[model samples]
Target: MSQRNRDAKRSAREALRAQRERDRARAKRKRTLTVAAGVVVVLGAAAGIGVAVADHGSSGGSDSAGRVIAPKGAIGKDSLVIPVGAADAPSTLTIYEDFRCPACDAFEKTFTPTIHSLEDSGAMRTEYHLVTLIDGNLGGSGSLNAANAAACAQDQDKFRPYHDVLYSNQPDEQDDKFADSTTLLTLAGKVPGLKTPAFTACVTGGTHKPWVKKSNDAFNAAGFNSTPTVLLNGKNIYSNASLTPDSLRQMVQAANKGKKPGTVTTAPSPS
Candidate 1:
């Protein structure tokens, strides 16, 4: 071949090589962009999942500390009242009691059986407003702790049994036995399924302490200065001099007379 022809062939080969290099570079840039877009999508999905989890935690009856807040329709901010009888019982009896109060223990001992009987018989339903009075009168977390644990028990539908047990096993008003979560758990063992990890976490972490304080605030706001205060049909029955455990049934019967058998006219009265 002539020298010029040979040079032309070499130039063509060089041009082909340059074109192949450009194609490879373009493919590499496309691959890099695809990988980057995939990373961005994955990161976006992870961030969205994080936000959903956080939203659920906040709105699902939990406080910022991950503690259970008061259940709906709870009286006075954080006080949980488990109704003992029919939902439509005519006469409503409200009891404001503290776990650490000796007076409350006496009141419970004297009236709990009768109250339960009345409740079972469908004559009346009782609303118990748990307070932490002894914690204020005495210097300790016993009342607050016990009340918190009791509120926690409500979450498990064991509030009534646990309430009875706490009153039955009341320590001295000043002993502060309820301050220890272990003692509360030991008591909870009496109720079936009450000693689970959730209950333990609630009691030990003082999850309901803020709720207990709110209850106490409600009690104070209601002008009650004592524990074991009882009200029947909006009347302060305990304030009456003739009130007795034996007379409680008669009072409920009288309150229901001429009124509907299952009509409660008032919300829970604070103690």
Candidate 2:
């Protein structure tokens, strides 16, 4: 072949090889991108499934016929809770309260009756976050003393009744006498099965001190600015002039409506 023709043919062959290499590189990049996108989609699906499973598992089972109650006596230093309704009843409510606050006392007297009835009827579950803000205000020892006593009561299974009576007999917020351990025991005596020396030992020895501290820690963690904060299914329930039995009931109903078999939304109660 002529030299010029040979050179031209060789150059054309090199160009074709280069083009083929470029094509293969492009295909490889496309495959890599496709696999990466698929991986992202799979990860997203896995995350969503994980969340759904968590929600389902947390809710437990269904209780269409009656209430299933779970009372966490004090979730924080200033929070108390009595969870009721079906474990699968579709809602969890939290009440952040102080033992010495008159407003909380009033709430106990006026609105809590309805709540207790609902608890009795299996409509909703309740939780109390017992806070000690009143202590600072009252020159009193705060809810800590009462919380310790209450935890002691829990050890003896007297928590619920003792709780009722404590709120029922709450003294002036400024007074320190009504909330001490001695008085708490005196008041606790009103509830049968609560006065055993065993229970007394727990209270005096501070057996349930950790539970009280847990409650206090949670209160600070939740960033609570005041006492008597009510959270329905993790949403704040206002307690001031805005609070009424009707309004509170509405929140309960709302909580129930959104509840699935095993999930809880934690919120603060309104001030």
Candidate 3:
């Protein structure tokens, strides 16, 4: 790769590290708030519960509520994994993210291009696991709503670009702007052919909400407390400060050193 590409790669890795640091701080803050809020509730009454658990469960998460309508081509048990890239790729990149997470936005902004490049080359396949940490943390349905919308996109073979679009236009963590179905539908206009009646209905009706909730439930049960928990070939790489897009590429190359590249699937993924 060129120098500029190398620089971009370094930047992506740095962003990942930075996001991890933020995740840790946020986790600590959550713990602190939980303890503090309890005391405040004992003394302040109404104000404490309102502030601590405001808008909780506003999103229709189907953890135990509705039918789990897994999207087209979803893999893994319970159809929880939304996969991209060639199915037979020698390496796998598993990512857990929330649409309303700043850490997730940072990761997508800096690392998506590299990931896309690798996917395009059939060097690796990516499995996306959507979670809703921000919904519980920040008290809104944006995480769940946006995740459902993404799942709907997957049904139309428009997930990769739509996924990128969601991150590119992510709302503030506290805003919950994405909780509105109109906003999600409007964003779909950016992706060609993704604004059809079915897509609109999916977003407006929260068609995949149950699946989103189930996926999140799995995330919580799996012991991952943070969004954007990235793993490369079953190994946690997000916490490795030395990791970079270049090194990741090298790892893929090494993994496929003596193997044939996976054939690209025929499914349409515009952009």
Candidate 4:
């Protein structure tokens, strides 16, 4: 081959090698960026989960009596326990739940039937303690408004109905769903017999603030450190798969084996 040809061929080979190096570098940079982006996403997700866990730690909640019903539905200075059954029932179960807590929602949907069955049978009474576990940092403004609205509904004799709607239609704990007063009022309308004006007035006027505060205080007093904490018959119900319907029934049956005539069930298994 001529020297010029040889030199041209050599130059082409060099250029090709240079292009290949550039391509390799570009691919490495892309791979590095992809890995970095994935790490960031994983970190963000983990952070969100941690926030949820922290917020739910305080539902430390459920039912009870009219010993002192607040006038005009003001969250009365008097501590109100929203009861599920006759006050004289042998076992008094308390459920501590956060509106934003997904696990609490699960428990409400899953085990509520058992509670209802017991209450219908006059075997138990229940009290609910509402706590605001989710706050602004956790992507919620807390369940504070919802608690107040629910209390206002109680003033109109529709506490249970409003309560059901709140739990059933719980918004995303990580979003702005239940954050506004309008949404709160909208939810209040779902419960039968709820007096919208009074409830809204109570909530807007902060009338139920004390009641919600009192509930939180009471929950703290009761040693609540987590959401969905169940206290049955003055005993804490521990978390266990066996707390399900069949197992709970078995537990009730077992407890009643040789108990007094009025004692139909034992305390909810503590958590």
Candidate 5:
């Protein structure tokens, strides 16, 4: 009874120990799987949140007003050109300017009356090409923002007045105040019946930002490196550094000598 009983007892003890070890291993595996699943769930949620934020950022923010800013007639290069006066005027006066440019402000302040006079008298037509060179060169959104707002103004047939007002109230080049849509809308109030909800939405939502970008691209493609570039009858009038408002009128008169009023003229090549 001694040796046989002792061996059987030892075998039973070893089997029980082995079974307990196997159970412990299974429990450890289960816990590891549960922790791994939790980690995956957490990572998935974090990735989803990251994607949502990225989408919001890329969408240029939400437009609460939901107003559509449509383009007016006579869209020129990049659909940003706002023409004034008779569309078929005898001579064509083209102006390339950036809202943040000081020289452009000076030019506009000095020559705006003369240009409008010619336009009102049906002597010559004008084309305004808005550019965002400041935004590209200075690393801010001012030029683009102003140009976009101006384009929006064009939608309401207020481009000419809005354009003049922008130049009149242009901020210092480094200020970047035009980056705020509220400032643009405030300036729009200068023009009669221009401060509407649609215009506000357009300015605030950057509705014409893509058009502004395209206009900028067109300016670059035209080989212009600076602002306040003026052309008359397809020639660079600003090239004559001594040109004045009076001289500009005389030049237009000369260019319109043979051509009749409301006569369409070809656009000049960039100098």
Candidate 6:
């Protein structure tokens, strides 16, 4: 009857769904590795992830999987957070997402404008905790590879646009095309000046693969079992069925009610 009760129920339902997904992942991992010719993993049924086509894989470029190379300016514990927005912003939005996550893409598409506006205005800061949920759940390296490439972009201070580009071109949940260095590099062309020698080497060498693994491990340890676990000011708002961009804005606005917005300058947007 109450909003709090409704939110609680929604959280319960989400938790149950996440548990089922985790169970399915465990079963999938236990099955002997089998690659049937022409057997493509479909998304409509598995987790209801219907999205655009692209690649998702980890096999192509993984020479640096053994090394933990955090991207430029990575902060927080173990250097796992790729932060956006001003450091002194009045509010903080923590997002744990996977590059291969359909839900995450949908969320980004729906909320990016509002989030960006808040960030640009210095009302909030976003900490992106990249994870490989789909890769672990569905058997691919797309999530990790894409996250690494995004990290590489961060090296050039281009993580924001490059991040949007990857989601804009997210592959089928089952497709491992994102694992190919060529595919990743090609996508880099979408972001201006992102395709450079250092960026290329970072993607091809999987320089941030180890860091991704560490972050994923942290995700598991934190009792989170799904992609796109979003928390605003330590409150889990994603589970609220009534959550929307406007409502999010209201919350942030209220949080920053009498506070002065930060003065950090945002990077130029991509064309």
Q: What TM-score does each of the candidates earn?
A: 0.69, 0.61, 0.80, 0.62, 0.70, 0.78
Of models 4 and 6, which has the larger lDDT? 6
Q: Which residue pairs collide, candidate 6?
A: 54-171, 55-177, 55-178, 56-175, 56-176, 56-177, 56-178, 57-176, 57-179
User: Which candidate model has the greater TM-score, 1 or 4?
Assistant: 1
Candidate 2 structure quality by residue, lDDT tens digits, 1-271: 5786455444434433443344356446657967987787788788884312222111211134433212233332233343433445455567777676665665566566667655554567677666665554434454666766766666555566787888877776557765456887788778877889977765565554444445655776776655566776677765333555666777667656654444323321211
TM for candidate 5 is 0.70
TM-score of decoy 4: 0.62
Once model 5 is optimally superposed onto the true structure by TM-score, how far is the C-alpha of residue 180 displaced, in angstroms? 0.6
Candidate 3's residue-wise lDDT over 1-271, tens digit each? Answer: 6897667557656655665666677678878988987887787665554434554443443436445689899999899999999999889999999999886786677678789888888889999999988777767789988999999999989999889888889977779999998998888988889999999888887778878888988987888877688898998887654556677788889888888878886544434
For model 2, the local distance difference test gives 0.58
Deviation in angstroms for 166 in model 2?
0.4
Per-model CA lDDT versus the true structure: 0.69, 0.58, 0.82, 0.60, 0.71, 0.79
lDDT tens readout by residue for model 6, 152-252: 89999999999988888888777888878799899889888889998998888777777787888898889876667889898888754356778899999
Q: What is the TM-score of candidate 3?
A: 0.80
Q: How far is candidate 3 from the true structure (C-alpha RMSD, Å)?
A: 4.6
- Listed per model in order, the count of residue pairs whose N, CA or C atoms clash below 3 Å is 4, 43, 0, 21, 2, 9
lDDT of 5 by residue, 40-120 (tens): 778878888431222111223224564323357646644557788788788889998889876677667667788888887
Q: Rank the candidates by lDDT, best first.
A: 3, 6, 5, 1, 4, 2
Off by over 4 Å in 6: 1-67
Please tell me which model should have the higher TM-score, number 4 or number 5: 5
**In terms of TM-score, how similar is model 6 to the real structure?**
0.78
